[model samples]
Target: MDNIDRKMLEILQEDSRITIIDLAKKLNLSRPSVNERFRRLQEKGIIEGFTARISHEKIGKGTLVIIQIGNLKVVCHKFEEIVKEEKAILECHRVTGSDSYFMKAVVSSTKELEELVDRLVPYGQLNTSVVLSSPVSNRTLLPEDEFLHKN
Candidate 1:
């Protein structure tokens, strides 16, 4: 993508609700041009679906936990079956390094967290950590992101 496309992505990542007119003004492009660019981005699969950031604590899911499941030969098809039924799990990824699977889950209380952990015991060696505070959580990516060059 070109600089203009990248800039539009950066803007959209910040606020997907921005009006076409406002976005055109920010990028110094015409409304029709900007709209076409956005349509192309979606058609090309460069832009995924937009989402709203929710406050988990306010919604009664106050506890956040990171779980690392190790000593697994594969992702284990049954793991997906079991995890899919759980709505508390926000994300689950098969990853490299010490952990075979990494998962993030949000729950209302410690009792709920324990129940979730118990159901996962048969999968692998599990290591779970409860998050107390987050200095940085979800930071949007841009063309000029420092993490992109750190490697």
Candidate 2:
């Protein structure tokens, strides 16, 4: 993608709520031009979708666990189906290396985490890590200024 596409992405990442007019003003471009760029970005699948990043802690999701799944070759198809039913499981991945799959789950308490563990046990040999704290988490890809300078 070019510099303008990168800049639009940067602005959206910071705040999805920013009005198209405001975005145009900030970028010093016409409203229609800004809208067109955004449209093209969406069409090219560069801009996937917008969503709010909610805090798990504020919503009573106090437990965070990273589960490593083994023996995925046996039940690859069923694994996706199983994880879909679970609300606590926020992220799932088919990873490389020793483990076949890695999943991040959030629960209300330790007991809930244990229950989540038990629920996953039947799938394969499970190794879980309870998260203590998150030092830095940058969900945003690139800032507008950074993207401009890089290009």
Q: Which candidate is the best by TM-score?
A: 2
**All candidates' lDDT scores?**
0.87, 0.85
lDDT of 1 by residue, 4-54 (tens): 888899899889899999999999999999989999989978897889999
Compared with the true structure, the alpha-carbon lDDT of candidate 2 equals 0.85
Per-candidate total of colliding backbone pairs: 0, 0
Candidate 2 wrong stretches, greater than 4 Å: 142-151
C-alpha TM-scores of all predictions: 0.89, 0.89
**lDDT (tens digit, per residue) of candidate 2 on 13-104:** 89999999999988889999999999987996778899888889999997778999987645777888898899999999998988888999
